[model samples]
Target chain A: MTWSEYGRLFLRHGWLMVAGAAVCGALALGLTTVQEPVFRARARISMIPGVMDWRMRDLTKELARNAVATFPSDELLAAVQDQIGLQTDAEGLRAGWDDGELIITIEAFAGDAATAGILARTAAREFHSRRSLQFTEQDFIEFIEFEIRNREPELQQIAPNVMTNVLAGLFVGFAAGLALVLMLHWRDEEWLLTRQAIEKSVPQPVLGRLRSN
Target chain B: MNTNPSSRQQDAQEQVAHELRALRASIELACHKPARSVVLLSPDNSVPTADAVWNLGLAFRTDTSSTLLADSDMEDPGLHLLADLDLAPGLRQWLEQKGQPASALAATHDHGLLVLAAGCSNEDPLQWLNTESIGWFAPALMACAERVIWRTPPLDQSPVGVLLAGSADAVLMAVRPGHTRRSRVNRAQRILAQAGIMATGTVLVES
Candidate 1:
């Protein structure tokens, strides 16, 4: 199609693009608000040498590794839920040891900050208790380290990236609107527009011209 | 610059009248003799031929007692609509049925300007045009009128237009500024030149 035809089409359907952009942008913001923000907290425990288990520490490390395999058992989660006063089924707890050498970390994520922090601490304590009973000595430190540093909240809100969401909505909406306009233009199949074009198609001297009624 | 509809319309009528007068003068000069007929063929049929023809006939009405604005376009004959003439019996019947025009010609608002409508024809107009009888029929119409202007079909749209162009003394093309394309104009001119038709020139209409 000629540029002037496209210009006419644009004038005809330009409002659609603007309306789509506005609706999509508002929808993006509304969706962000409707969905809850998630907060995550983490705690770590390490199996260290103690008085009785000091000489047999290497052998105890092996024992700790064996105990780490069942660190996040359903039973452990049930105990942590009881300690944390959780009314719901296990929804926020996750525990794992990296390569099972010596350290185990427990993480919790929830819609609220307090629950996430409580769940994390509870998981750490529950895992330590079970491992202590596995050996004769209490070598499992309660919480050797906490993930938090520099005044960071235990459960930090990590969702609803406002700027990114709005931009995505704008791009998608505009593309859809433009496609609709072009499709409409294509459907309208009138091609001839001016005197020059008609003359080129048929050899004739134009005796007169009149406005289209 | 006037945006008023009535004023704009009056200005357009005046402009068309002026152009038609100029066209009439050009045909008179090109024909160089009395009883010469000019075929008005547009590359696109949608141009305002009825109004142009009326104005053209009016331009010559004061000079001559007999001038004919013949509507030779059989397929779509609407010249009567603009000329304020009811559907009447005329030329096409004279040629096909071999009957004389048993009625008077459709007279327009202009004095000395007569309209010969395309008339009723069920046979293929193209076949009628190709017959040798077209040679005798054109001169028969010319014998009665001082100057005859035919509103023929578009040159490229139908073979009838080219045939009419062949029979007439000169071919005058009508074109609308926005509706008519330059390529179609050039192509029509080329086709007429190739077919040995005397294409007088163009009449550009603002509509």
Candidate 2:
């Protein structure tokens, strides 16, 4: 059915549809409300290009190669864990590489928000210290800015998925509601007018076309 | 008569009376065919006033002794209101007590017209109508009246009119000036035709 036709059916059976939707939505929300809450914390680490020796003839290409190969090493992670004072070892930390940036994500269920935040910040600082990078506050800020710029293209690609799901849900719900209204009327066999009676008697399929607005 | 709206109203009433007399003649002519029973439907209940049905009944006078003006429409029996009759000991009570073949006739103020009203109760009449009792009682009622004129419910929506008068020798299609549509007339025709019946003719009613 067209969107406007579906809307008219909804209005005709407005009370019934609203009652059903409200009951269903309330049950869904109630189910969600009763479940336990889980908190997720993320810490970011930016990779920097290393200085190259001029004694190598292909120094510029070598610098590019080294930057591409660079990753968060286990030795650096161990040093960070010790500094951060985390109860678990470095291997327990969750980490992933996106573009040239490394993101360490920590998910924990805490009784309170304060404890979760403390654990997140401590982990981030520990990782930074263990990387053996001599970083001034200004240098750290610059590195974070560079990594964000590098990750922009990948983030942009996933945004359309959210919009597609929203439109898809609305279309499906409208079709379901229209089908329900037609089914109810057909079951009752209310041939109110001659047109309706004629249509029923015919062997061909009678398409229910809406009048022009 | 003064030349004003009241004078125009008087002229209209005369015209309606003329038409009613003509319709009465048509019904009488129809009875010449020797059918078992003929049910004439009056477009009076659809009128604004309560006396409309009674007035219509008086207008269509046939001198035959067995000719009956029946009040069979259960939805809105305007006859009871016009005749100032009690709502008790009538059709519904008889149905409940005796359970169909309830052919005990009640003659009203009009000597020839006998009424079967909706009865005294606040309930949807379909419950009683959909029972086996009316079927059992209909043949007996048919026997009592030579030519029965039944004032039935709205033909488009209610089954009361369809069940009582749909299969009569002449189901007069009653159409109000603007309210009745061609499509609705076609529907009424089909309903009657399905039962191997057709109207004597269409009556154009103006109220």
Candidate 3:
């Protein structure tokens, strides 16, 4: 089809796309209001070697790896929960290690910013205290030290992104509407509405076109 | 700029009249010889066949040659109404009673245009159309005027329409966009082809 024909096709059925976009956009907007918002907070704790020794650096790296592996453990979660009076279970807490920075990152999610920040800060503090106690009677105590990189939790609201969800809904709705219009157009093939359509089916020449009364 | 309804209607009518005149020229050019009798057929009633025939008759009128418009579509005759003539004493009467073709013809407002209405009859028109008298009806009507134009029923709906179309010197099909179906046109074409007839050309009716 030519560009003009495409233009005509869209002109004939463009309303469907507009209506779909409108309904889907309204639905998305409505859902944003009803859905619960989620806020996220993160705290990073660095593992540093107290002495400038290769063995001590290697030990600090091993300790950081171990901390990452056990960061999401139930025992750690229970301790953090007791410290912060958390209402939710272990579902809200997560941990990861950035090897390049020798940092163990603690993240927490909650219904509000204050609780999320407190959860992340309390988890980081509890992990540091437990690791310090574990090495209090060993020689590793003079080789490793733990420092909280950010005294305050970095907080953000991450869920129920209104603009992104609404935009996605409108795009999907428009695509579906276009598909329906094309299906309907092809289904009614027997109708000869254009000169090209009529000419394709008949052998005789079209003499002239007369306007409707 | 002229938003008057009457003016718009008149403008539309003028445009239709102009297009009909162009169609008249096309028909004249398509036929090799001077076609004394031309039959107009449509795939369905949605097309304005009667209106085209009436306008073509008016367009064909000239100082030298007279044009006779006949409504042979007995099932749904409309040319007579377009010409503001009665429904009786027309082709039906001429076919039932072997009267002079001139007696059945009614003169219109135009001096060069005459009309032969689809006359009233008690019996079925198919019976009258099938008779031997219908064969010579064209020749008899041609004798009354220089040009004869017949408006028949939808070719796909009535077998009588195809039969009448076969007797004419030239055949023209009328089709309306969005209303006329491709299958119906194909069926009409098949029926005409079965009788060794083909449409000389087609007129695309916007209506």
Chain A TM-score relative to the true structure, per candidate:
0.55, 0.41, 0.77
Q: After superposition, how far is residue A137 of candidate 1 from its true place, in Å?
A: 20
Q: Against the hidden reference, what TM-scores do the models get?
A: 0.53, 0.40, 0.64
Q: Count the backbone clashes (under 3 Å) in each candidate.
A: 44, 1, 0
lDDT of 3 by residue, B125-155 (tens): 6767764756777678889999998888787
Candidate 1 lDDT tens digits, A5-42: 66877898898887878888888888888878887887
Model 1 lDDT per residue over B19-103, tens place: 6666667665655654267777777665767666665666667653678888767777767776667655766767776654335
TM-score of predicted structure 1: 0.53
Q: CA lDDT of each candidate? A: 0.65, 0.48, 0.81
Tens-digit lDDT string for candidate 3 (A1-213): 678867977898889988988888888889888889999999988888888688888888887888777766788788887887767677788888886777888899999999999998898888778787887766677677787889798999988999988998898889888997787565444677777677766788888875543
Q: Is candidate 1 or candidate 3 better by TM-score?
A: 3
Ranking by lDDT: 3, 1, 2
* lDDT for B106 (candidate 1): 69
Instruction: Specify the highest-lDDT model's number.
Output: 3
Give the chain B TM-score for each candidate.
Answer: 0.81, 0.70, 0.87
DockQ, all candidates in order: 0.25, 0.02, 0.43
